[model samples]
Target: MDTRFLGIPELVEVPSVAVVVDVMRAFTVAAWAFAQGAEKIVLAESLDEALALKARHTRWMALKDGPPAPGFDAVNSPGLLRSVDLGGRTVVQKTTAGTVGALAVKDASLVLCAGFVVAEATARLLRRRAGDQVTFVVTGEDGRADEDLACAQYIARRTTESGTDAAAYLRRARESRAAAELAQGVRQGAHPDDVALCLEVDRFPFAMVATLEDPLMVLRPYAVDSLAD
Candidate 1:
């Protein structure tokens, strides 16, 4: 099967199966929650809806993102998720880019969330769902991104050639090399902790997909530990 890459602007031409990434934060936290034993995740783009869902379901924990507008349960931070016990529970999460990308790809045949933390499983899922073309729609911070481009490059290279050299690409992307030029000219900066959190390669064994509930697309999380092997 052939592989192709697309930025956010080119999402419409994306194939049936798509991998949506917000690695610097959102999907990383989702991976962490899965590691902590969360059963399912419902992604709500708005805080009000997420809060309402959390209120209705006692087992759900809400993850809020973007700026701190006050009164949110928590902002987009992997550190905050460490304090919760998600075993047998559900999570209602919201992020600037992650949930939005999930919503955007609602029409795709299959759309799964991915991060550096869950790259291996994500890759396996992508291969299983491979089609004439594979798209990686990266959700960037504040309408632009630097980290997700590197992530797109990682997926494109791996899907095209098999296996990504994380350390090599990280160095090149970090140094702003020619092939790694996408890493430059970013107007946003993720938390230092977020950078560290999102950099882990395949630390978790789960993949999340979107399910519809009217206008909202809820994330349905599942364990894909077998894919890791």
Candidate 2:
């Protein structure tokens, strides 16, 4: 299978396995929610829709940013989620990147959410599914993030053995050691906290897959934790 990278702009053209990567926050938060046993995740492009879903669902699970207003959910921070009890419930999230990327690629045959925290598991899942064509839709800070590209390179290596070295790319990306570096590499600029929250790896092993039945993505939690960055 030929592997191609799809930046946010090229989302409409790709129609393979969509690996939506929002390492900075959105995707990372989704992975965490699933680890906590979230029943479903509605990926909304606007804050009002996410908030409305939450309100209707009795406090829906959500990420920040979208129509209605920006910063409505406090800008997609994991620290904020620490205090909430999401057991047996679900979330409808909006974000500046990941969620929007997922919505952008909704036409894909299978849309799988991925991030630094769940990178390894995502690779394993992709390999198992072995979708004929694989496209990585990594969202940048705004529309560009070299770090996201670098991470996409890393993920691409895991999914294929085409003599492409993902380890070196990952190492280069990690060497910067600053959240800003990843954002800048991908051309996405954000607050320092956004970078900080996105770097933590393997916090959860679950990958979210959104389906039409609930409109919200479904998460499958794996029992593994702890992976080398």
Number of the top lDDT candidate:
1
Writing each residue's lDDT as its tens digit, candidate 1 over 1-229 gives: 4655555656765357777877657787887777777777788867888888878877667777654544445556666566667787777888767888877778887787887676666666666655546667867743246566677667666654565687864553343321132223131223445555667776776667776767657666666666532
Cα distance off (Å), candidate 1, residue 112:
1.1
Count of steric clashes across candidates, in order? 0, 17
lDDT of 2 at 7: 76
Candidate 2's C-alpha runs over 4 A off are 66-75, 141-143, 161-178, 181-197, 214-229
lDDT (tens digit, per residue) of candidate 2 on 113-154:
877777666666677666478887858744456556676667
Q: Report lDDT per candidate.
A: 0.66, 0.63
Supply the TM-score for candidate 2.
0.75
Worst 10 residues of 1 by lDDT: 178-187
> lDDT score, residue 38, model 2?
69
Off by over 4 Å in 1: 66-71, 141-144, 172-192, 213-216, 225-229
